[model samples]
Target: MDSINVSELVERLGSDEDAVRKMAVFKLQGCVLDPSFADVFILEDGLTKLRHLTLHATGNTLAYSLTSFSRLLEVDKGWEYVNQDLVERVVELVVTHPLVNILRGAMSILVFIVSHPYTASNRISQPDSFGFRALQPAMTVYPQFLEMLVSRLSSADHALCANALLLINSLMREAITNDSEADWPKFIKQLQDLDVIKAVYTLMQSTALQDLSHPLIEFQALTKVLLRKWRDVPVDLNKSDHRRALKSIHLASNPERVTTPVDDGEEGSKKRHNPEKWRRLGFESETPAWEFEEVGYLGMMDLTEYVRQQEDGFPKLLLEQSTKLSEQRCPIARASLAVTSILCEHFEIEKADVDDAKIQLSFESRTNFDKVFKPLILQWSLLHTAGLQAFFRLWQTTGAETEDFMKIADLVRILLEAVVGGATRVSDVHEVETEIQQFELARLRHLQMELLELTYEDHWGHHLGQMRDELDHEALQFVKEQRIRCLLAGAWFSNGHGHKSDNVAVAKQDLNPSNPTSQRYAKLAHNRRFLHYADFDVRDDEEPDLEGLVEKIDLTTVSSVVLAPSEPSSSTTTLKATHKFISTRKVTIYGYLLANSRPASPKIHPRMGSTATKTPRKEVTLLTLHPQTQSLAAEWLDGLLMLLNYKPITDETKRLIAMVQDYGLKIRLLNVRFDDMALAGDSPEIPSREGLDEDYYYDILGN
Candidate 1:
């Protein structure tokens, strides 16, 4: 290399042709690694000017030079000149740099600056929490820059446009494949822009580049990068809306991933974001991975994210209130619908496994499982106010929407439709006698289908006790029907009505025209087989009137609904599941409340097993009635153990033996106080009634 051409190279390093300047600056730096320049370049101002030239240089010209300069500055004692002002300017330009490639390599400088002990210490001392942020500028500008990059993709300059899009797209794909979201909104917005859509669509139209045939790169960026970031935020650090409003971006992004499943590690990483990436890396699997990706999956992430945030806020009472309002049971319903919606999206993914019933968790029972929404509810409902609502929703959907229940409803609908189709195909057997069974099948099937629809819709809107008021909301109709059905079921099903003699006549009267589902079952009104549906207080009547649904449910089943505690609804029933009833064996123990449990239809009969019989599920409790504060010592463990058949042995007890292993709950109880009621009553203090055992916490919940 030629020496002493510093003057010429500095001039050229600022040239418009980035490649020429990049080569010149890099070449000059290698030659001048010599320490002799220290004396000749002694003036601090001269070094400052050089530093400015290196830092402010654009594109390759600047990036190539800055990489060496960053090294040189550290190698020299040049950091002595660093101050708050200089550091800020250096960080600002590195962050706001317009060129994508220039910005990419330039971030290391900010990373370098903030990584210094003094710098890190200085940042933490300040209140804004920006010391760490200065190092990760990608978090702030990434979303914005992604927006710009995406817009450029639709440009008319084919070569530049295609090259730029290809490079940016690849970088984004690599990031997503790594399951990283260095900057989510910026990154997603770019891919979602029209340029990406048009480029993929236009490429598909022509058989130009065989490489352009796949759109996995774009989709991976959308789901793994964008949507995932939006949903899978750090719970403690999150600042997103509970409903996932950012998903409007998906409208511009490919939506196939909503139904696909993800693979583990690198085999999955290269799948969608870039097929060539997979090919280049020598990872072998089918190109363009689409499994574990889907809208339903995204929905799960969104709701789960809210739960995670709620989880983070559990310690702060005021914050817990906000989280409860923000997440709580609504997400449970949302996730329930979302998983069910996934079933509708792809028929083949789930081959209908036998254990689906076993694994199929109620919104109440599923706690801490990754895809579960229940843990989040438990986290929120632990609050004094939200507990009851959590319990109510849990029970409301239990009998009406157990996985077994939905499965049964599905079977009925399918058989009914099959019968209807068969009746349509036959012309000779059109007589009323021949069609009676088919019609009956269709009617019963329709009832089941409607019930499924009811359970699928969420009754709670944005707040507890606040019913969704929009008349046009189809979801509201589902809630209203449930309310009416429960109301009518309350009054007529109980023996208090005293007309328990002719069951057929009762069924027919309940199925009369006034009932919601009566059209097909009207004949039952005369036979006393009418089913009491619910009770409702019509404004015109001074008293709540008794009404019934079109079908006759078992009276024993209706009695199980604990409608308003001792006040049984007309729909009361005692019939259990098809299996034998898990007789009234109750115990008190501790576990999280599932959610707001509402009264549900009575249990179904149990299935006859070959050897080991299936355990019957309890009628999930409707709305957890929290024990009084004064009763924590005497009642807390006893009441909870009653439900789970569990008792606290000692802190040394293992989880398998201990029915409840919730850490957060144990913390809450420590702070909770029950007043000394005996002192107020002048009966003297009782040692058995107060104070928690310190050993229990240190062994179980304490660090």
Candidate 2:
């Protein structure tokens, strides 16, 4: 590879043959890789020739030179020369065409100019240039170079904006790692500038998750020196949040990872939001090791904001901007919901954070749910529903994940709990109903005034009153319908406490929300329409389990038939209808059924997808415990039998108890009362008692 003469290389740039010009530039750039060679290159007006070609270069030529420049800057210390006039002209060209033209070599020039050590450092205390001289003149012009980049970032094509982010990230990664922290504050301030933040966010907003590694990953890293409380960060959570979110490939700083502390919580710890507790919210037992860049975490935080807007804000421009970007509702639904569900158990998230934006931040943007719920619950509800739809869409699109099922359980419990709590909160249920009707009318009147008009000239007062009256009637209808449903559902689950951290019963449900059985129980118990794909056994005319289960009798060799199956059919199996046995809280029995019987009346035909094998297989049928046997179930089962007043297990019930355990109901329990009444009254602590052994009991898992 013989290098070409610099002057001849300069002239050949305009040669009729593109390959010749490309080869010439490639050879010239290769020669310039040495810092010593920069002087010679500058000697023959080489920069002028390079600039000429940059303005007219085809992708192949430009890509070669631009890539060469990035490499050259890594080594060369003397090539930061551009005549004042030429630098201004080129910088202006980049600023103007940077946004509109993706392949016009503007990015290449910015890359070249910004690579100089002058503009690379923050304005204050810039130590030196590439060659180690503190040349104030060179430093003076540096701001202009960044200004050009900022302009491009603010108004460029989305892809170009992505490139601009790449440029900044590249610089940031290197500087944060090796450079002194003296100028870090200014640099970070620059980073948060609207121009810069918008560009980075747009790139993140546009990237396909399948290709999360493209460019974003290449530049992925944590700003080891953050503005607030950078110290004492949990290394594992940092590593996990980063890996799961960013899929980061490069880290600027290899900060030592810290072990998340495990706290054996006491009464005081339970009252506070604990980091250890958040880790406990992992869909499973342990936090798996995964690392991601800070950018991914930041992007996810933004997603929470998007959720807030979708659920409560509904700003016309924010939505319109999203549409213009063609995001296809992902930000509204999946991205935000993923964070919300995770954050529900994620560290630092208090219930207060949900509306105030403390954990995820939006309060400064002025939309805290708790503070403004009375005025904006409906507006927020609309956005929340929109966000919920997006979450479903995202999860559906991604196929089922382990966490997906757990999240499902949490969300369902939350939904039901909200309804139940609303029902129980006010005394004099009928008056509460009347007030709800009035509230609906007031809300409707407010909406009418905003969306349409009760014009002043056209019977304004009368028209306004009519609209209010009409909605008032509709409000009454809504309250009536809600009351019927909530009355039934609330009494069943004992209201919103189901989703609370202290709610033992529903919290247990969170472990397996997506399980087909749980979904089945939820639908049947609530009498909500059949949920996605569920299969439940509801038989009460005879014995509940035997009624729906198909039983086969083989008088030949079989002494008894048993069954065990789980989830829906292999595909498209819907939960069978389940009828509730009672309107009030019924003490359903669970544990071993010691009774000896001949005909398991409704011969269980066996659930469709049996985990049991062929031949004479023992079966496990999931059934509700009858009130008569509930006490016996409690006696026979482990601590799982808390709800029922029953005696201890007897030898007679051991076999039946083992059968019940397989269906996943051996949960921790206590005698703490969490019925709907508890929610409307004062929050009281349960008195401590020497808990029964875990072999069958708990210390109040009350929510």
Q: Quick one: best TM-score, which candidate? A: 2
lDDT of 1 by residue, 652-690 (tens): 222322223222223332343324223323566456836
Per-residue lDDT tens digits of candidate 2, residues 103-143? 23445444444445444443344344222122224335554
- Measure candidate 2: CA RMSD: 26.9
Once fitted onto the true fold, the runs of candidate 1 whose alpha carbons sit more than 4 angstroms away are 1-24, 28-50, 55-63, 70-132, 135-703
Per-residue lDDT of 635 in model 2: 27
Model 1 Cα shift for residue 119 (angstroms): 10
In model 2, which runs have C-alpha deviations exceeding 4 angstroms?
1-7, 11-92, 96-106, 109-127, 130-159, 174-183, 207-214, 223-229, 232-703
How many clashes (backbone N, Cα, C below 3 Å) per candidate? Answer: 92, 37
Q: What's the lDDT for residue 150 in model 1?
A: 49
